[model samples]
Target chain A: MTDVLVVADHRRGDLRDVSYELVTAGRELADETGGDLHVAVISGTVDEFADKLNREGVDAVHTVDYGEEFNHGVYTQATTQLYDELAPQYVLTPNSVNGLDYAPAVANELDLPIVTDTVALETDGETLTATREMYGGKVETTTELEGPAVVTIRGAEWPAAEGTGDAAIEAFDADIDEDALGTTVNGFEEVGGGDVDISEADVLVSVGRGIEEEENLEIIEELADALDATVSASRPIVDNGWLPKNRQVGQSGKVVTPDVYIAIGISGAVQHVAGMKGSDTIVAINTDPNAPIMDIADYAITDDLFDVVPALTEEFH
Target chain B: MKILVTVKEVATVEDEFEIEGTEIADQYLGADLNEWDDYAVEEAVQLQEAGIADEVVTVTIGPEDCEQTIRQALAKGADRAIRVWDDALEGVDLLDVEAKTEILRGVVEEEDPDLVLSGVQSGDDSWGATGVSLAEDLGFEWAAVVNHLEHDLEDGIASVRRELEGGVEELTDVELPAVLTIQTGINEPRYASLRGIRQAQRKELDVQSLADVGVDEGVVDSDLELTDMYEPESESDVTVWEGSAEETAGELGDLLRDKGVAP
Candidate 1:
C-alpha cells in the first residue's frame, strides 16, 4: 500500500481553486496505490482550509499553522517533515507560482526526483509515468520514474474534488528554523489598471506574435474599432511594449470572459487560454491550422490574419 | 558584485513538422537563445551598467554547438561564458532536474558569485525548477517569476515584484548572495549591437568537461526517463470557414451580426 500526500494551496484568506484539483489528483493516485490519501494545509486559517479540503477521498488532514502568507522556507520545512513522518509514496502539489517556489526545494531536501507541470499521471506501484507538454504545448511526452518522487500538476487539468467528508483533522507542529529563512514577503499589489479595462468589455479583439511586427497592430485596432470591441493582446505584444500591461490577457495579466473574443494571429498557449477559455464565443484567425487556439475556438479562419482581419474589418464598416 | 546568468540554447519547432520516435525531426528544428533568458541577460547587463555589478558571467549546460547562443548573451553585454559538457551527456534523451541541479551546483561552487540570474523556465523542457533547485543545493535564497527588480540593493537586500496569476504582484525582499528566476516584460531586451557583436568574438568562452567542473560521470544517470512523445490531439470541434480571405471574413461578420455583438 503506497500512500499519497497532497499539499493544498491558498492565497490571501481564500483557498485557490487548484487546491481542490490537487485533491482530485491525489484521490485518483491513492485509488491506484490502494493507500490512504493525506492532505496538508499550511499557514493562514489552517482550520478553515482543512475543513474545506476535507473532500470525499481524503483520509486525513494535517494543518501546520506557520505564517500568514506563503514562505518557501516554512513550506519546504513542513512538507519535508510530513514526508518523514508519513513516508508516503508520492508528494503532490499544484504547479502554480507559489508551488514553483517551494516544490523543487522540498524535493531537493528529501533527495527525491521531481517532475513538474504534469498534466496526467499513472502509476503501477513502482514506476510512475507522468504526461506533460513541451515546446510551448506543441507536443506531449510521457516520462517514467521510479517511486517516492515529487510531482506538480498543472491547473484545470483535473476536476476539483467535491462533497463533504468525515476525515480526521489534526495539527502537526513543525519546527521552523527562523535563522535559516532568507526571503521576506513585503506585500502584494494589483497592477494593470489603465484607461481601459478589457475585462468589462463585451467584445475583445486580441492579437499575438503572429502579427509579425508592432506596426501590424494597427489592423487589429481598426478591426476592434469597427466592431465596437476593446483591444487586448497576448503576452508577447505587451512584453514588446506594443500594448499596455492592462490590455494583456493571460495568467499574469487579466482574465477576460467577453461575449466575443476574436483571437487574431494568436496561438493560444496554455497560459493565454487560461484567461479567455471562459469567453462565451471564441473566434481564431491564424495561418497555422494546428495552432492551439483552434482547439477552443467556436469558429476560425485558417488564413493570414493580415488579409482576413482587414476584410473582416471592412464587413463591420 | 559579481553576477552569473544561466543561459540555454533551446530547440524551436516549425508549425508543420514530424515526430521521429521520441524526438521532433531535426530538419524542422531551429536553435535560439531562450526568450526569458534574454530578459535576464538584459537585467544583468543593466545592473552592470548601473555600476552595481562589477562583472557579469554566463554559464550554460550544453554542447559546443550552443556556443553561438552563448555568444548572443556575450554580445548583449555579458562579460564571459562557461560551457559545461561531456561525452557522457551526449546520448541522454532528457536531462532531468536532479542531474541539471548537480551539474549547475558544480558551476556555482566554482564561481562563488554575489548573485545568480536565470530564466523562469526554458523554452523547450519548461521544467521551471533549476533556479530554485540550485539555490536549495547551495543554501542560497531564491525568488521566482520576478518582473520588477529594484536596482538599488540596500542593506544587501534585493526587492522584487513576483508576477502572480490574475494581475497580482507580490513584493518580496531576498537577502543577497541569492538566485532570481526572471520573468518576461521585466525589461526590453536590447538587440545586440553591431559593435557589441564584433566585440563578442573576442570575449573569453571556456569549455569544460564534467571532470573539469568536479562533477562525476554518474550524474548522467537521470531518474526520469522519456518513454513516449506525440503531438497533443486537437480536441477542437471548431467550425472552420474555408474560402478566400473576403469570404471567410464575411462569414465571421455575419456571425457577429447574428449574435448581436456587432452593428
Candidate 2:
C-alpha cells in the first residue's frame, strides 16, 4: 500500500490553518492509494503540536523537537530522515514561505520529483495527476507525475480537515549539520508597522487596476470608512506605487479570509482568487459582467465601479 | 562582486486563445520580459549603482527571439547577457521545473556570480521553483519571495526581508554568494533612456547551446507530462444584479445586512 506523508507548517508556536488543509488533501490521496495518512510536525515542543494533529484520517503523527521557530537546516534534516524511515509514496507540504524554503533541498537530496503550487490532485493508477494555473490563471494545465514525489498544495484549494481521532504520536531525531547551514533568521519585521492589517479586518474594500491612479484611492478609502472596513488592493495597484505592498491581496501578497470581501474593478485572476476565495461572502463591482471575478462572487454588479462604489458607500452611510 | 539576474520572455494573451492541439495558437500580439523579472533587473541595477557590485550579468533560457528581453535588461543597466538554448529544447514542456533548474544550474556554474537573483515566480508557468532548486544544487543559502534586500560587501553577508502569508515579513541574513527570488513591488524598475538603449545595443549578448553549458541533451526530458490545457469552468451559482447603480448598491447593502456582515 502507498502511504501519504504531510509536513505540518507552523509559526511562532501556533499551527497554521494550512496544516489541517494539508490533512484534508492528504486524507483524500491516502484513501485513493489504499494507504494510511501520516503527519510530520517539527517544532520545539512536538507533543503539543502532535496532540492537536491526532485527528481522523491520520494513522500516525511523527514529531521532531527542534528550535522554537522554523529553521531551514533543522527542517531539511528532519524531513529527509523521516522520509527515509517512512518511505511514503507521496509527501505533501504547503506552498508557503517557510515550506518552500527547505522543500526543494529535501527533494533534491532525495532525488524525488516535485511540483509546486498545485491546486488539484487526483490519482491515476499509481501515478498522480496534478492541476495548476498559468498566465495569471488565464489558462489551466493538467500534468501527470510519476508516483513517490513531493508536492506543495495551494491554500484554500481544499477544505480544512475536521473530525477527530486518537492517532499514535511518535518522535524522531534528526542529524542536523551545523556547518551546512549558511543562513540565519534575524527575526520578523512587520511589513507596515502600526498600520491597520487588512488581513485581520472583518470587512475588506479591495481595489484593483481599475482604480486608475493614486489620487483615485480616496474614493476607496471613503467607502472603507463608511463600512468600517479596511482598504486592500490587487498586485497592480501595489506595483504602481498607488498602495503599499502590505495592502496588496493576491498570491504574492496576503491570503485573507475576511467575513466580507468587496472587490472593485478586479478581474479575479486565479492568483487573486487563491488569496481571498475563503471569504465568507464575496461581492464584485465591475463593468464586465463576464469577468472571471463575477463568476465566483456571491453578488456581482455589472456597473462601473466609479458609480457603484459611491452609490454603495452612500447607501451604507 | 558579480551579480547574475535571470530574466524570461513570456507571451501575453488576451481574449479568445486558441488551443492548437497540444500547443497554444502560434499567433500572439508580442512578447516582453516577464513582469516579475523586471523587479530583479531593477534591484540588480540599483545594487550596481550603489557600488555593492561591480558587474551585473543577466541570463535567460529561451529561443533566439528572447534576445529582445535580454536587451531590455541590458538597457536597464545590466552589463552583459547570456542566452542558453538549443534545438533540443524546442517544444520542450516549459513546466518541467527539474529540467529547467538543471539548465539554470549550468549557467550559474559558468557565471560564478557572488550573488544570484531571479523573480519569485514566472508570469507564464508560475512554478516559482527554479531559483530555489538551483540554490539547492549549488549548495548555497537561499531565500524566496524577498521584497527588501541589502548587501554588505565587506562582511560578505546579505540581509533580506521576505514577504510571507497574512502580511507578515521575516528578516534573515545569508552569507554572500546566495540566491534570492525577488517579489514584485520591491522597487520601481526604471525605464530605458535613449542613451542607455544605444549602449545596450553594443553590449555583449552571448548565445550558448546546452552542450556549451555542459548539460546533456537527455537531461531535458521532463518528469511530468501535460495531459490537457483549457480555461477553467465558471461558477454556476453566481447572482447577477441588474439595476441602476443606486438601486443595485441598495440591494447589495440589504444583502450584506441580511448576511449579518453589515450593521
Candidate 3:
C-alpha cells in the first residue's frame, strides 16, 4: 500500500480552508492506492485544529507543534524532517501565497518535481499523477511525478469531504535546530491594517487598463455602488495610481475566489485569471469578444464597455 | 535606492508552443521576456520614475540566448543589465530558475540592493515559486504574490498588500532589503517604446560567466533530474457555449456540476 502525506496549510491558529481540501485529496490518493491518509500539520498547537479536521476519510493526523506562526526556514526544515521520516509517495499542499513561498525550496531540496496550481491528483497503484492548469487557464497539464512527489493543490479545486474518521494522532520527534533558520519572524503583520481590502469582497467589480484614466474610475465605482460590490482592478489600474494595490486581482496581486467576479475592460491575462478563476460566478464586460476573460466568464457583454457599463449601471440602479 | 529586477527569457507566452505527448518542441517559436517577469521589470522602472529608487538594474540567467530578454529590460529604461549564460542549465534543476537565482544571489551580494523583485511566476515552466526560494537562499525577508509595495528600505521596513481569498491583506512594516514577488495586479507590464527601444539598443550590458563566480563552467547541483517534458493530454471534450448568457450559464452550471466542480 502507498502512503499519502498532506501538509496541513494553516494561518494564525486557524486552519485554512484549503487544508480540508487537501484532506479530501489525501483521502482520494489513499483510497486509490490502498493506503491510509497521513496528514502532517505544522503549528504551535496542532490539537486546537484536530477536532475541526476530524473526518471519516483520513486515516490519521501527524501534528507538529512548532510555534504559533509560520517561518519559511523553520517550516521548510520542519517539513523536510517529516518527509525524511515518512517518505510519502505523494505530498499535497495548498497553492496559496504562504504555501507558494516555501513549497519550492522544499521541492528543490528534496530533489522532487512538483506540479503547482493543481486542480486534481489521481493515483494508479503507486504512481501518483497531478493535474494543473497551465497557460494561466487555457490548458490543463498532467504530469507523473518522479520520486517522492510534491504538489500544491489549487484551493477549492476539490470539495471538502464531509466524512468523519477518528484514525489517530501521532507526534514525532524531528530535530529542528533554530540555528538552521536564517530568517525569523520578529512579528506577524496583517497586510491591510484595517482598510476594506477587495480580496475579502464577496463580489468584485474590477477594471483593467482599458479604462484609460484614473479619474474615470468613478464609472466603475458607480457600477460597484449599484451592485453593493467592491471595486477591484488589474495591475495596470493599480500601478497607474487609479486604484490602490489592495484592489488589484491577479497572480502578482491576489488570489481571490469571490462569489461573483465582474470584469470591465480587462483583457484577461493568465495572471489575472489565475487569481480569480475560483470565483463561483464570473461576468466579463469587455469590447473584445476574444478577450481571455470572456473564455472563463459565465456572462459576457461583447460591446463597447463605455456603452455597456453605463447601461448596466443604470439597469442596476 | 538600488532595485534589482530579475526576469527570464522564455518562449513567447502566446507562441504556438507544441507539446508532443510528453515532450515539447519550440519550432518556429518566438522568444520574449516572460510576462510575469515583465511585470517585475515594469515595477522597477516605475519605482525609478517615482523617485522611490535611484536606479534599476536587471539581471537574467539562462542560456547565452537569454541576453535578448535582458536587452529588452534595458530598453524599458533599466539602468543596466546582467546576463549569466550557461548552456548546462537545460533541465529544471540546472537551468532557468535555479541558475537565474544563483546568479541573482551573487549580484545581490555584490550590489547590496535595497530591494529585490521578481515576477510571481515565469511562463517557461509556470513555476510560481522562485521569489520565495530566492528569499530563503539569500536569507532575505520575503513576501509572495504581493499586489502592492510601499516602503522605505532605509528604514529597514516595507509595506505590501497581499491579495487573499475574498479580501486584501495589508502586510505592513516588513523588514527591508526584502524580496517581493509581484503578481499581475501590481503593475501593468509596460511595452517597449520607440525612443526607449532605440536607446536600449545602445545600452551596455554586463555578461558574466559561471567562471566569474569561482564555480568555473558548471556549479549547479541539479537536485531534480528532468524525466520528461511533454504536451498535456486533453481532459475532456470541449463544449463551446454559443447561446444567450442565461442559456450559457444554465448549460455551464449543468456541465460543471455534472463534472462535480460546481456546488
lDDT of 3 by residue, A197-284 (tens): 5656777888998888777888888877866778888978866776765676886566777777778889888778877877877777
lDDT of 2 by residue, A1-317 (tens): 76888999998778888899999889899888589899999975689988888878889999987777887777877888899999988889998888888777778778888888889988843789999987777778888878688889987778888888678888877777878878788887666634456777789999998888789899999998888788999988887777777888877788888888999999998789867877888999999888878768988888988898999899877
Error of 1 at B24 (Å): 0.9
Candidate 1 structure quality by residue, lDDT tens digits, B1-263: 99999999999989789999999999999999998899999999999999999999999999989999889999999999999999999978899888889998899899998899999999898999999999999999999889999999879999999987656789999998899999988998999999999999999999999999899999989889999999887658999999999999999998998889996
Q: Which regions of candidate 3 fall more than 4 Å away from where they truly are? A: A170-176, A179-242, A258-269, A284-293, A299-317, B1-5, B15-28, B35-58, B74-82, B87-117, B134-143, B146-263
Give lDDT tens digits, candidate 3, residues B35-74.
7678788888888898888989887776666676678888
Q: Candidate 2, overall lDDT?
A: 0.84
Model no. 2, DockQ: 0.64
Q: Native contacts retained per candidate?
A: 0.83, 0.79, 0.19
Stretches > 4 Å off in candidate 1: A194-232, A240-247, A250-281, A285-292, A301-317, B240-263
Tens digits of per-residue lDDT, candidate 2, B1-263, equal 99999999987776567776545686843588988899999999999999888999999999987787779999989999999989998877654767777888889998899999999888877878778788988887888888899755468788888877666788888887889999887888899999999999999999999899999998777778888898777564778889999999998898878878785
* lDDT (0 to 1) per candidate: 0.91, 0.84, 0.70
After superposition, which runs of candidate 2 have C-alpha atoms over 4 Å from their true positions?
A193-202, A209-228, A239-242, A257-259, A267-274, A277-280, A287-292, A303-317, B236-238, B243-246
Better of 2 and 3 by TM-score: 2
lDDT of 1 at A155: 75
**Model 2 per-residue lDDT at B71:** 97
Per-candidate count of clashing residue pairs (backbone under 3 Å):
0, 0, 24
Q: If chain B of candidate 3 is superposed on the true chain B, what is its TM-score?
A: 0.81
Evaluate every candidate with DockQ and list the scores. Answer: 0.57, 0.64, 0.21
